[model samples]
Target chain A: MAHILVVDDDEIMRALLSGMLRHVGHTVVESDNGQGGLEQMNAYPAELVITDIFMPEMDGLEFLITLLEKHPDSKVIAISGGYKAVNACLSLQMAKALGATDIIAKPFHTAAVIRQVAYALQSKTIAYRRRAER
Target chain B: MNASQSEQIQNTEEGYPDFAKLTEMREELGDHFLLVMQHFQSGMLARPQKIRQAFQNNNPEQLALEGHSFKSLCRQLGLSQMETLSVTLESMGRSGQLDGAAPLIERLLAYGLQAHCELQKYCLACGKPSSVQ
Candidate 1:
């Protein structure tokens, strides 16, 4: 079991994601937006962070950028739903280029969320080892 | 495509939520269903104000940002009209076009309140939350 952070402006979305994570035996932290997410990390860093791309007063992109700059070991997974409506991949693509460890689109199923978490957790070990080597 | 197709896609009167999605979440949440929905209600309540504030501030990016999050919320809940309006708002914000946004914003408010009222009916069905705020 790992500690994870979920950042989204919508409370329901945060509740749903956190609930899913908790049910699977992982401890979860919730934040309303990117700014709050950073604050939560400073208060008590988590093993992984799953953030949404669009938010007010410090969006996921700014959050990801700042997080990586401050904590080089941080593992992040970005999410979004706007791409589907806008019919574009630019946001997710930019998230990848900005260094999200992985990405998941919104309206994801429970199985898919769990699968992504498992994969991200696996990478945690690899990240730690690589850092230890350095 | 055609006007009929557009109308069909934009139809908002179908319902407040996609019952199938609600059921899936209900199965997953068990006792927490009411609480989860209540949380949605409160968040949705605050949405229109924020949208209007963004519009008043002439911040298309903010509108887009709100739409981005709102779209996901409605998508999961199956709030068709709210979801459709949110998409249009997001696109308008992206293009920085304010024309006709006034009416759409009002429509967003209407749909949001309508969904809230409808959701309350279901929350009552949950047989919990004596005082669902």
Candidate 2:
């Protein structure tokens, strides 16, 4: 099981994601926002991070950019409910461009979360293997 | 949507918290559902103040941020009406259209309180701590 970091301003989302991650046998760390997420990583780095796009005290885009600058290979999953006047797909596309390994929209099913997390980790493994071959 | 429709969504006889979703979570997380929900509810209690402040200050960005967080929290607990309301409010903040945000924010607050009461009832029924704070 991999260690995962969860960063979201909403406490409920954090708790739900943490409980779900832990239930699946992975170690989970919680943070309220991007800054806290970075601090947690410094305290104990995680293999993957699931972060919300809109947050106070450091949004996910800045978090993703900074984390990648420090550790380019860090796996991330960006989530959002879409801002008003902004299409959800468009927002997720921005996340993908920013290097999110995967994206999950809000009001997601639990199964989807499991599937996406597993798939993201698998994709990372594949990328790592490809690099080793080269 | 009209006020009647909004009221209908909030006061549906089906109950406050979505049972099907909560049951699914309970099945997946087992006893941890109660613990997680308790923590979630406490966080929700603090949201109104931030939202009200943002609205008062006419900071659409801040209001949108609060709405964004609220939307996510409501989604987690399966509070569909609250989720919808939050999404609308968030959109207003994002688009800088604070025209009707006050009433909507107040409605969101009302639903939040209602949800909390429902959660307390659920906790009491399950023999867990109703007041997690």
Cα lDDT computed for each candidate against the true fold: 0.77, 0.78
What's the C-alpha lDDT at position B80 in model 2? 77
Error of 2 at A76 (Å): 1.6
Model 1: runs farther than 4 Å from truth?
Answer: A83-88, A124-134, B1-15, B53-61
- Model 2 error, position A36 (Å): 3.6
If scored against the real structure, what TM-score would every candidate get?
Answer: 0.78, 0.81
Model 2 segments more than 4 A misplaced: A125-134, B1-15, B95-99, B127-129
Chain A vs. true chain A, TM-score per candidate? 0.87, 0.89
Candidate 1 structure quality by residue, lDDT tens digits, B1-133: 2345347545646437766777677666666566777777766676866777788899998887777778888887888777777777777787788677787778778777777776777777767652445
Q: Which residue pairs clash within candidate 1?
A: none
Residue-level lDDT of model 1, residues A1-134, one tens digit each, is 99999998878788888877777788999999888888899999988999988777897899999988777688899888755344326777788788778888777765677788889877753346567899
Interface RMSD for model 1 amounts to 2.5
Clashing residue pairs in candidate 2 (N, C-alpha, C atoms within 3 angstroms): A84-B91
